[model samples]
Target: MSTFIAAFLFLLVFFLLMSIGYLIKRKAVQGSCGGLGVLGIEKACDCDEPCDRRKAKDAKEKARQERLAQHRII
Candidate 1:
């Protein structure tokens, strides 16, 4: 329909303009209210000891880092 095409074009242009503004600013997007920093909390999941899921994620990250380190020639 003509009405639908007009509305779609308007939205497409609006989104393109918003994206251009963001690209010019080059800033990371964050919640409007800030986040854990506002509450003075550090890590998202801060436990005395990490849970199983957290442990696995950490181990995976560690392994990834080690693999990257191994690939380094210098």
Candidate 2:
């Protein structure tokens, strides 16, 4: 039980230090290894033309935004 408590305290202090360092630097949190490019994906939407399903979803989102704008109080 004491050994477990010591290990937990060590890990807690280690992560606290890491968090403070990140806050000081304001660095973006990302994968430890290189981002998705390692898997050959340049981006989520790399295709020149979006697929029909994606197109429909985008259109729906656009329409929703337009409706919200029309009803916005300002």
Task: Find the candidate with the highest lDDT and give its number.
Answer: 2
State each model's CA lDDT, in order: 0.85, 0.86
All candidates: TM-score:
0.44, 0.53
- TM-score (C-alpha) between model 1 and the true structure: 0.44
Question: By TM-score, who's the top model here?
Answer: 2
Backbone clash pairs for candidate 1 read: none
lDDT of 1: 0.85
Cα lDDT tens digits, model 1, 1-74, are: 99999999999999898799888776556678868878877768867888999999989999998997899655
Per residue, candidate 2 scores C-alpha lDDT tens digits across 4-64 of: 9999999999999989988877665677787778888876777889999988988999999
RMSD (Å) per prediction:
5.9, 7.4
